[model samples]
Target: MNRYQADVPDGLSRRARSFVRVHGLRVGSLAVEDYRSEWLERGIPSAEIDRVAAFGERWGGLALPPSPRYNGGPRFFTPDTPETDPSGGWWFEAGEQRASVPYGFMIGPDGEFGVHADRWVPLHATVEGWVESLSLTYHARLWAKSITKLVHDEVETIDLTGYVEVPEVVGLADSWWRGPDSLVAIYRGEAECLAFPAARTAYIYSGLDDWGLHG
Candidate 1:
């Protein structure tokens, strides 16, 4: 079955279109699991993979981390997978230490997106086509962080609900969040949470309710 209503457009990478055509724009598509691990993989069963599919059908699926392998890019597992904690959301079971929560931005007309019970919940977006989807997701992520950009020297951000076009973008989540010098916090929605260490720093999400966090 065709996951999208139309064909792949432009702007998105060849990888994004490949993903959309084969996997139907699912956030879980990036999940490369270690099913044979002693460590546990815990998450909300209600994360509802179908919801991701539905979102992809409506808004647009995003090309997530894996490129540049940083700036929020989720790295492929090394020798040891990360820890799994059920209390918060989905996570690979490594040790006392946990893996970075995987996150992806979903682009929709309302500027809204989806997440799992996990805090760094992945997302699913539905949109016109692959090329069109990338720009939408890129713009939407900037909007979520409440960041601003210059288009012809005018402060601008893409707003699907308004008179806007998906602006040019690359390195989607690269440097998407940084603050207080050498530290940052990335929030996907209320569902997922995570805590991890980077170069001389760390990120922690308590998994608290964030119903209005976007507002």
Candidate 2:
């Protein structure tokens, strides 16, 4: 079994399996410093830098400049958020708020990080297999966003063939086969959105102004 499979919930729907595999590979490519630098470089502007400071605190400490690094953090997902779903794996960075409203990337659970997800796949609902059901869909006509995943697995093979570009997951929930070659991928711009009979959750940005989604 692949190292990523050790943590995968064995019976996950095919799409779920694909999700985990893709992200496991992604997380493996990153080192500890990448996480810290991303926050410091793209971090929201603040005088005290308190948000990143506290965020780093959860990770133990924040390193900077030549040897910046985040120490003692979860292997998958950021430290849990306090105000919302304590059950969620990560909280959207609260610092990048736009027009006074929170707008940032978040993963793990619906409504936990100010992201309202439309359920496409209904798993057991505990969040164990939850992270395995996320992917990116970009709308470049509006803004740019880079998808990120946190996983730890080593693999020599990563097949990029599973990606597809579709119109909508909402349309596929009612009709998609469970065949070996079955997949319903939606692409808005340059990114592909993985869709499934059991995977409709997404960070909703359609109605929010001064706010939009990158993935």
Candidate 3:
């Protein structure tokens, strides 16, 4: 069995699996019972409990390499512990951030993953989206003939007229779009969350074929 399959639930996408094969760090899973009482006391809904438990069993304690744009990626906490959000939500301390803006990374009650400062800011609708985005990025970097980066106002210059959003990533502030022969990725998580205009960024990957995109 693949390393991810050993503990991950529902499995991962082909590209995501490839990324894990190359960059994933395997760790022991934490059973749902490990955090049951704590989660219950926090008033985490039963449905949310199941989701968080599954995430803990699958990805907890494992750290991926830094995201292509930042100094650190998610480093999940073990046993799926959650802290009550003052905003009347429950959240898990997902990981650390090398970037100075946010207090840290957080997985919100709705499974949205992003950074938490004064409030929870969702970057992607699901943690799986983040993984998928990472996988797509590495794949694009390997196969694209050229890569271009844009920051802040420059991001608005790229016209995505013919591109369609990649649905698998379930993006919020971060998203991916695919054109006929290229892909565009936009990241607005940090900038929007921290109100820091300089943090807006985007990447363009050109000269890719079907194999490079989906293989």
Best by TM-score: 3
Which of candidates 2 and 3 reaches a greater lDDT? 3
- Compose the digit string of candidate 3's lDDT tens values, residues 1-215: 66543233345688787776677776554677766787778777777777777767666766565787645555544545667776787787665565654457778878888877775678889878888898888889999999999998999889999899998899998999999999899998888777888899999999999988775
Q: Which candidate is the best by lDDT?
A: 3
State candidate 1's TM-score: 0.24
- Report residue 124 deviation for candidate 3 (angstroms): 1.1
Q: What is the C-alpha local distance difference test score of each model? A: 0.29, 0.28, 0.77
How many clashes show up per model? Answer: 23, 7, 0
Give the per-residue lDDT digits (tens) of candidate 2, residues 72-184: 11233333232233443233332221222112323223322222233222221322222322322222223323322211121112233543322223222111111122232
Off by more than 4 A, model 3: 1-11, 28-32, 38-51, 76-80, 98-101
Q: Which ten residues in a row have the lowest lDDT in candidate 2?
A: 64-73
Residue 190 local lDDT, model 1? 25
- TM, every model: 0.24, 0.24, 0.84
Candidate 3 clash figure, as a count:
0
Instruction: List the candidate 1 regions with Cα displacement exceeding 4 Å.
Output: 1-15, 18-72, 75-82, 86-89, 93-215
1-215, model 1: which lDDT tens digit per residue? 44432344444555455544543332222222323222333432333333333333333333333321224332211112323335533333111112353543233222222322234332223222323333333333433434333222121122223212222221122112222211123222222223232211212212222321121
Q: Each prediction's Cα RMSD?
A: 14.5, 17.6, 2.9
**lDDT assessment of candidate 2:** 0.28
